[model samples]
Target: MNIIQIDRHSGQTSSQILAKAMDLHASGDLHEAEKEYLAVIARGYRVTEILPLLAGIATINGDLQVALDRWTTFLDLKPSHLFGLMEKGALLHRLGRWQEAVVSLQAAERIDPNNPDLLLNLGIALIDAGRGHEAVTVLKRVADIRPGNPLVAHQIRRISSAIVPFWHIPMLNDQPRNDAFEEGIKQAIAAHGSTARVLDIGAGSGLLSMMAARAGAQNIVCCESVGIIAEVAKKIISANGYADQIKLVPKNSKDLMVGENLDKRADILVSEILSSDLLSESVLSTFEDAIDRLVHEEATIVPRAITALGCLIESDVLAKYAFVDEVSGFDVAAFTELAPTRLPVHGKLTSWRRLSDTHDLVHIDLRARKHEASYRQVDLPVTADGIAMGIMQWIRVDVAEGVEFSNPPDHYSDGGWLQVVHTFSRPISVKAGDQFALIAGHDRTSLILMPAG
Candidate 1:
């Protein structure tokens, strides 16, 4: 049997008030319990102990603001209070004050560095604060401490996917593309000799820089904009015994300074920033900036030209992904407007029938001082009778003199480059021997493909 607590209005000892507060809290009379706890604080008795209890009660009552204030007061009294800092950080995180939560959690981390709970909270706060690179670094430590923790592994994967594209590893494994770039790099080094300075703009994996080093280039500069990837590249370069010959610049090539970062303009410029669609990686602007500011006037550019090649395609699977006319017996053709204009599809993975012969859509000269957007309309004679989905596009790289690489759908497989399908506004039924007019061009950074009426 339980008895109701009696109210003493005046001259109660602080301990008596605290005992009554705990009794009220235990009885689920939170409102009165909060008043009794405040009375204890007012009487200046065991405030540090009472504040945490009050804060926990406030949190349970959905009074987050009051809880935050109580925790803040407790921290003021005991600045290095570990549990106070942890609770404050967790509260700030719930309140969406991510940076403040990170600060508080990090302070707690310094006090208890090996605590997995503190590290997990800090990682989440860093992620919500848009500091994904740092979050991954912190979460990796958590993974080490709690090995095979699915939550930690899941967080690390989610952050990695958000930060890097899936094709990066496959691109590194692309032998043909790697060989072509290596050949161009070696040829350039043969011509320029060991004194030539080689600049690799997007040194993904530092492969090209290592190639240059192996080819007797004494000076090589590799730049990768992503911080985590740059750190990985540094490790790989060091492991390959080229750390002394190659210097890694963990910044965008645009941010590089001439006299401070480089002794002189590079004699050879190498970059593989080309996307599956040829220009989606901002290759034009990046290359233009390099030519104008980062390289010698006569610098030998690897992949001196890139051409966009495309063919009309018809695929039931592609049509399903690109268009919608009816769904569950509902006339949802209007929903087709929301379909993606361009979708990357693996040439070997996706099944599509070619409706027309492959043709050159557009070509970019890497060494040109400047580029202007241009469009052209071409007539393609359809060779097959089918429903037209859109143009399936690929890339051909002229990587230096006598070195070329093309990812045409017919022959190329298991490479980093995937064909991009430019979806039409609507599906069109076509017959063999019909001439189809198609519009193709670029908007400086992306290739444009459209059906011409």
Candidate 2:
């Protein structure tokens, strides 16, 4: 029997060599341990067992190329080896060879599809390859595999940037938003009477039209861009016994015709199309299109209008997210580079101070026929001194009557939509009355803000 030596030159057994390698690994003598493992590998002894050990040693020694080679070698011998495949895939990912990483991870997933680690890696590899749709599928699978996982949830959100349809933004649901629209509809009916003709554009839930119907509107036309959501909205309307009072138009607001759908122009137009910062939901274009093509020249637009409100704030906690710094034995300053070119932030969870109190940013008159991209520089007076983490923003919609309603700071809670706190480049300090200049505007989808002179 050919006895394979584990100790290489010392003629020890494979088990003894592995023990030495593990001890070296434990003792932090990675380089010698790697050499010993490689010597055992050279003797053709227990390749499968020793390969991962060698790869790990190479990784600890900062020899990524060697580590990758060893892992790849191990996978070739035992393709179903889960850890080896993961190591190989991760190495490729770190090297920025995302396509190759995808291939390796897919191989791993085929062997062990239920592994959330492999699924996440596969999703990331797909994302790096710019296959966002595919990434979304895998990420969602990872989400399903590990529900409530922040990392999985985060990847799902990242993939959404590539797939969110033009209409998904406003159609998404929120309790505060629904209540605001419902209350507005009630007031509109109280003021205009129940016999008024109503049109609800971007009718996500068909809720507004139902509100109008309950408020006494004889005829209500509701339009939604998403086919599935529109179908659900219709079902909801039918379930609520308002099927006869509401007409669901499963199409974009621009597709609605005045004579065919309405039999005449509408007396009222009610919609809740405000995104986080109001304009991000494409309220300008959608409302502009509906007003120009569908709404009556003098319609009572419930959410007659909406204004984006904001304030500058600062915080150390926010800096961790929006800026670069070191932490926990690692130079994580590279993390700052990972900050989104733009991102939606929550103000309540962050630790920041007010550099400026809330002020009006931009308002879209929903009843206007056409809206041009507009901008204005505003001076926000700082009421207190604090590190400026970001701009906290929310919406104030003009519902009806002299009965104006606002989601004041104290009551402004979280849901599908909340105050978006957009972080600054660095924290800014200001004394009382220091004016923070900001340039604010909208370009169809979302509101943009930046420092202004």
Candidate 3:
């Protein structure tokens, strides 16, 4: 087909040029349509209407930057234009400019707060920008407006997976953990008196704070780093009738101030920030900071001590995930180095056989003012003859003096704490009577597990 060349000498009107541009755009001749649209804009003919069409054509032509520029220009003319803002924001998101997209979508959200489409886009931008907590909040609003929307629910789940671990729900329902923490709170109140000021760090669902309040603690401060979790904790604390007694601080424990955030240092400190691998949640630094800046010299610490316990394991199922050698007759053992060092495994769901008796790998004193990373070598007597895949590790929490909780893989079925598999570089074969030397410790934020040479 030949190009439809417009003759400037024929006195073509702006309306005529716009009609030709629309016809070319409808016929899928975007290049010609863009030229005609530009001519129409130059003549100042229906600039607002033609600009969006030109932008759409640019988008269709695979010129995203051009499309973004066109939409930006249209927005300048009509700052309050709803669709203009939406297009600009959406374009920015496609271009991988997440923060810019968030800014634009936020403006659109301000214009129409109840619009589900705007909220959905804004939530996506927030997630892309590594703001999953904020995304969850925005997406929850979307769910409220459009009930039973599967996409909203799916997005919420996706964001939740990234922000919160899978074990939190089960942990919340763990009767033993709850009972242990409650007992510890009661003991703390008994020792420090009911009026003692309490500090709860990593206040997930505000369960510990409510426990303290129920134990007759008059003043309590709880801090949660995740904003969404903190908001939900507020609701839970309020619903449980402890809102007045418990103060919710939506910031990290490291940021809490003694005089400004709290009237004085707390008399009792309680926290449930322990991870499956013990130190993954920065519990060491958090507790150390609390002891330094947020707690008194003799503050009663719940879970006064924690220990990382583990046993050697052997499993074909776990081996498939941890180490891979050959695939389709090709040696890919090198790929095993790229595998995750630590894997969260459901205690009851995963199949594995213990090859050695459980032993304490590391111990942490919660009352200590400072901590340094340390490693130690220990020998474990093998109880079974099998190929060693890794060590399955769990945590033992000594909450107060008498209350204690341990998530051993054999008896602990349902809880937030999943047993972690610390995989070795390669599988080792051993006999029942063999003794295995192992190195274990922590680097403040993660557990270190390896076989000793």
Candidate 4:
């Protein structure tokens, strides 16, 4: 594939030319050094070494294609050249040849699988190639090799942030949600017996699967779509001694097949895929698919019900997301239409007064086979006299009989979950004892709440 295939030019003075090239290269005279290296290369005297020197000189002189061609030529002569592959990959990445960059680095990786530098280059190229999940897996291996390397850690963090949602790390730290899920899993095992096949959707860090294992559920299949998370979850599950009991699959729940990705239909379903306002994670569709295709009839579903609860509130901070009137000297109220429909709010930190008592915005029974997106009008009982900005919503998970969790605004400050404020098209005025009409429901993927006449 390289055009630099020249016939060997045998000469008596080849050694002399190579020595002068080395001297010129060391003296930083790259232009002169390149000439001599080319002379040595043309003479077929240590062409491999001379080619790399000539390529490096071309790269320094800003002739990347020439450098790439030289590397390609060298590789054609000696395809298994390890450093050549790495250099070629790095150059390919710089040239925005994404997939080719990954392929080259991967070739180098196959030769020296555990070399940290090679792995690092491969990981970076994978990110640029849009293979973020695999990049993260590779970067994690680099981290294991060079523990204190800041660049690898930063790359891992950057790639992870781009691929995984920000809430997962915090969600893992949500003790109440964790405790409720564990309790529910324990009860399910008690009722279904330890041998019941369990499916954990949105496996995340494999926490729920591990919980099922702790409760003595022997057969667990957990699925997570994100590659890096799935790989790290395997390590965590193994570290916790549940590797044999739990099987992790990097796939969406909808794509999983019974008897293929699962032994049979699941007998117990353990999942915490509920979003902040309850449905933003596509919980309805995801659960519906699993119930229809993956889980068996009468499967014990954790959090048999979820409630989206909220109160109409007034907040100066939240108003900014809803409306704008005078800026400089213009009637900019129309600009409010371009504002965000909803925003995540930390209940304790956000300044707001409830205009009405918390009401059930929407509720879904997880055991239901299907959910239809629908809306209904609610007569919210106003408890105070204030301007109603919008509805401030949170979630309640009824895991089991006595195991339930709700991240109410006043208490759930640190959880990965946050109360979402669905800003109204315009702020509405209300008074104590006035029943405010509101439209409330979900589009299946997000909670929808707005003002009603």
Query: TM-score, each model?
Result: 0.91, 0.59, 0.90, 0.80
lDDT of 4 by residue, 1-453 (tens): 767766443454888877887898899988887877787777678988788888888899999999999999999999999999999998999999989999999999999999999999899888888999889889999999999899999999998899988998899988888998999999999999999999999999999999999999999999998777888899999999999999999999999998799989999998888888788788988889989998889899997999989999999888987789889998888898898888888999988888888788899999999888899999998999988888899988999989889999977787999999999888888999998998988787887798876
Please provide the root mean square deviation of candidate 1 (C-alpha atoms, Å).
4.0
Give one digit per residue, the lDDT tens place, for model 3 in 212-330.
Answer: 99989999999999887888899999999998999999999999898888999999999999988899878889999999999999899998999999999998998988899989999
Q: What's the residue-level lDDT of 236 in candidate 4?
A: 95
Lowest lDDT sum, 10 consecutive residues, model 4, at: 3-12
Q: Which ten residues in a row have the lowest lDDT in candidate 3?
A: 6-15
Best model number under lDDT: 1
Candidate 1 clashing pairs? none
What lDDT does candidate 1 reach at residue 181? 90
* TM-score quality measure for candidate 3: 0.90
Task: For residues 1-453, write the lDDT of model 1, one tens digit per residue.
Answer: 999786664777888888999999999999999999998898788999999999999999888988999999999999999999999999999999999999999999999998998999999999999999999999999999999999999999999789888889899889999999999998999998899988999898899899999999989998999988898899999999999999999999999988977889999999999999999888999999999999999899997999999999999998888899878989999989999999888888889999999999899999998999988998889999999999999999999888999998877887888989999999998899999999989999888899987
Indicate the TM-score of model 4: 0.80
Q: Candidate 3: global Cα-lDDT?
A: 0.91
Where model 1 places Cα greater than 4 Å from the true spot, the runs are 1-8, 26-31, 42-48, 73-81, 110-115, 141-154
**How high is the lDDT of residue 374 in model 2?**
76
Off by over 4 Å in 2: 1-179, 190-192, 325-338
Question: Once superposed on the true structure, which residue ranges of model 3 sit more than 4 Å away at CA?
Answer: 1-10, 22-31, 43-46, 143-150, 153-162, 347-349
